[model samples]
Target chain A: MSHQFYSIECIIPPHIQNNIAEKGTPEQRKKVMGSISQSAAIRAQRVLLTETKALVEPVTVGGKQRNIFNLNFGSNLPGILARSEGAPPTGDPAVDEAYEGAGATYDLYQQEYQRESIDGKGMRLDSTVHYMKGYDNAFWNGRQMVYGDGDEDLPEPQRIFNRFTIALDIIGHELTHGVTQFEAGLVYRDQSGALNESFSDVFGSLVKQRQRNQTAAEADWIIGEGLLSPNINGIGIRSMKAPGTAYNDPLLGKDPQPAHMSDYKTIDYDNGGVHINSGIPNHAFYATAMEMGGYAWQKAGQIWYVTLRDRLTSTSVFADAAQQTYLVAGNLFGGGSLEQQAVRAGWQAVGIQIDAGDSGGNGGGTGGDTGSGGGTTSPGCSTALVQLLDNVKALIENRSR
Target chain B: MKISYRRTGGFAGMLISHSFDTDTLPKTDAEELVKLVSAADFFALPSKITATGADQFQYTLTVETAEQQHTLEVGETSAPENLRPLLEKLRLLARGKPDL
Candidate 1:
């Protein structure tokens, strides 16, 4: 909790936002800028809040606790309480969708990974819908998720984005950011940053696939499906099976994700291509899952979860992640087993080589040998979020002064 | 004085840029922009902003004044409050330039 953890995983990348700003009509440009400004403002506020000691304590809540908030087109965090856990659907599409999406994500981590909630300690899941006027993005702003209406006010054909909460994978994707905050705490820049993004995409897709009961072969492997407005000439934002093939619209441009390290982008934009280069490891996970030939969440997801929770450090790069997952796989499925081989193949496909000698407890240099169990029980999380709610209230009060 | 702003990074890996000489802008607006830029103290800002993994925009601003030339890379969220108007003006002026 003492370590500052803040990241915003926007469903729409900033390049797309910049493109829309340039290519869209006056109104569309305003909407996209609104989204960008909102994001910037939230980040600025988050940096200030995280520096305060009062906001960094963690609180444990038993079972699934979700709170869906209604922003009503105003810029506010955790807006009016629309619904709480076990509440009846209010017939409000945004509220209901947010509620249901959070539930499904919670179920996935709890049922599949045996973790309680995003923090593995039953941390409360909070979301805000209808954030700001004409906002066009959804993001996990460190503490909670906030979604926009996706330019709904515009007429058909002109609208470029659907409601942020419409796609369940988007919800799963944002929530996984929270889990990453609690777990690996990966430094959100360069290669480490991409791994953080890939983990979210990997689990986000699994949440959608598992909900549909689709096998690895049956899954589409696309993140943010149904997120773009109908007029856009793209299926989704990013494709896992095929990284750069997701979208190619006149305004949004082509997806620039690289499936291999050779094509990795090293620029400082998008936090060293966190969203772009994630395609490398994302493809790795898909390949590993397909090779195993069953439910991806079963073995593939388990290997990733263990690697992320127990092995990864804040500075882990792609090679570090590959090594940890390979070692974790050997422990979970036995050394030289098919599952372990699949893990090796996954990293190799991404042009990252896992040293065969660095097997079973030899990797993840910060930790000790994980032994034959392969799975290490993640340690209990410290205080960070529960104290945030209290600190935010104080901040709001101070702002009014 | 000539000023240029280049924006890079984001989801799509695209770059957008625009530049204008102070001699071209309206006298009053140019004066306001010069004052704003001076107030922002761009040279004093940190080299990198916070390390959050959002699809943030990075702006490289180049100023060619009679005295000297200076360039700095700034995260979108890290720009000082006094510099907001200048950044917005640059982006507004950059509109309609065909994407490169």
Candidate 2:
């Protein structure tokens, strides 16, 4: 057994060992650990050699690796590998589109946000296209992307949708759901679900904008642009800039998204209106980006990304999103800076008021214009300290109540 | 026997519905529908089956017989294996309808 353990180190490559460490069963992982410990000096030398090689050669580590599959109009996932990373186009529109879409989505997160991939650990992106005949939807499925061909089987005059992979933002949107799953794990119901949907739309639109080199003002802010069929009286599935106006066709009914909290729909279906109410926060993001007046990804996108990655929880509501984005903007820029003010105005435009108490104690208050910049006077207290004091005060108030 | 199905909350956020009475169909089709419903043990299913994921479809299915009627709401991920064939049949039937 001791000889076998030493032999294991010689046989298995370091990359395979890393993979086993991450995904192997507990017993297997323990065995791998023992082998690693027994061969520390050899492993160190190997690591140094690998690092030296990497320094001299171009590295693909933490880079995008996409796998596109053809479902062949079947329901089974990843039915057949149509394209792999760095592969040439297959001439099949669905396969090629899925391939390109995944790459573009990967680029958005990797280039703009410094996120390695959907899981923030260079997880390989897998997408299956042509899922089920005339299937009119796409989804993240908690693991990989699944896209339907839409009403392609229907007669041209009656078709209501194009292929699910037609829109780059839709691909970005579904991929961002994977990001949200790895991050906040927002429950797929009620307000948290709406926030989940909103985050997808926010990042999805940003992906398209960055790819197009569009400024905040130049971008259309549509979630599923060009996805609807030509006969349909719709530009897209939903509009972040103008939520309820995305579509209004006799066949598809109307887009029911509301732009403000005052108009929030309390419906029984659609998971407490997750898709519907997402418009509020979507518009809020649009407003924030518009106010910031540059590439939306620069400030507005960073604030939302940090908030989603750090501050928001599974059960966070609209108010929590507003508050956290404001705090994150303040933290990233400066307290009461233009970016923070833009976030505040964005949420305010959507009828969600960030609690003044939360921002008052941001502590890095460079702007003396804010009336409640009391935390700025206390230079000894850090922002975290001020936040702690606020939490304590809130706890006392809740207890008394 | 009467059956109705509504699907909501996909990535596109579109709503689709289809309803039909077995009596209106040919005898063979009606019998097949009855067989599918019976095979699914529709009445035995819980009123709601919950699932967690983003942008998956939610289905509302109602079946009516001479004596009783039952409605079940299920998410796509949580939909039981037995229930899927019936859902698939209904989804195919719903295609090409004006409201789809």
Candidate 3:
């Protein structure tokens, strides 16, 4: 198995696609199936991308540079440049939304976390709208953002999916995947993969919250707020406040997310339930934000940002993330403070016990397998085994020295 | 003789299945399917596909003839190129979509 270098992060999960294929009309089925194939083909392209070294110059403008493209129902990427920085809106909903959403995300990272951009180096934000004919999904293809216009051929009741660019949080969610790629570089598989997904959701919520200036209490923690069609029995794709309750429809099926570690899925599919089990950490973040009482991005988001940017390695597990955030929260806001306590409680809410006293040996230390690997976290050898081996190796090397 | 195919798992996690009885199918299509199945050596295909990530569809083909019945499973990304036409036809039939 080769090292899994990149990931295709989509707003709609696979289970939802499967549900549509089974229950949707013949036209809907064709659209959904085509989306599945398109996404698969993009994943295949991602593998090829890793093989080549593409040079991307860091943007050093006033802040961020946003470039929007229109696929015009075609497959080619970054198709036609619809808008760019300092340009007026083209009166197109998708283009305007993508531009504003990218700007909002940049502002959140810029003003809150002081992140230059998704890469912390002012990387130009590139997006493509109307990716394909009757496409049902939007995704970050480990490179640029792509959105679909949503299926228009289905009947009103069967029209359960809206345009991909309809939701601001969904845009934030997709862009955060790019942030994860640059920072944690979380291998998109297994527990670490879930962490990759959870981080994206966490920050995605933050971007939306900061944009609306909504507090944790005031904000609706739904990830894809307006992305779902009105005819569906669902509110959104995934709800951070209530994981499994996000959607329950005859066509979409029930949301399969588990908010606690005990209920975590251990399936071989979906890269070990990367998108499904993310509910655990997502709830943890939501809890932490609620406990902090105010804007979530202020304290809770900061801790997670610091953890993602500095503390987490590519192979860090849920426990490692929980522990690292606990340590970082204390460091950011004095030990035993309300912020620190909230961080500790957050992990505990998700069945991950992070000892308050455990400062994690060395602060911000690279634990276990550092960069991307074969996308699999070894069985039974989790954060504990990683720490143990590190200690053993340290002892042997010190003795020889 | 009966030929059945089912496709499950994708971004939406949908399952679509259809069966074609040799006696019920058009003579030309049935002959083509048999030739395709035999020439493609459906039985030799792998049982399960290793998915690279999310949104992958899994295809299961079941063929029953006078001698025996056989089942073959392949993933969307891992399936051999030879099986494309057969899988495409099966998906269309399963969804009640026009194959022509």
Top model by lDDT, which number?
2
Please, what are the lDDT tens digits per residue for candidate 1 over residues A70-128?
98876546689999999999999989989999999999999888999877667789889
Please list the residue runs of candidate 3 whose C-alpha ends up more than 4 Å from where it truly belongs after superposition. Answer: A1-62, A359-401, B1-100
- Measured with C-alpha atoms, the lDDT of residue A388 in candidate 3 is 36
Tens digits of per-residue lDDT, candidate 3, A80-129, equal: 99999989989999999999999988888898889887666677899899
- DockQ class, candidate 3: incorrect
Better of 2 and 3 by TM-score: 2
lDDT of 2 by residue, A178-281 (tens): 88877766778888889999999999888899989999999999888888888999999999999999998877778889999999999877888899999999
Scored by Cα lDDT, where does model 2 land?
Answer: 0.77
In model 3, which residue pairs have backbone atoms overlapping below 3 Å? A14-B11, A15-B12, A16-B12, A17-B11, A17-B12, A17-B13, A18-B12, A18-B13, A18-B14, A19-B12
* Model no. 3, DockQ: 0.06
**Rank ordering of all candidates by TM-score, starting from the highest:** 2, 1, 3
Interface RMSD per candidate: 4.2, 2.3, 6.7
Give the poorly placed runs of model 1, Cα more than 4 Å off. Answer: A1-59, A361-401, B1-100
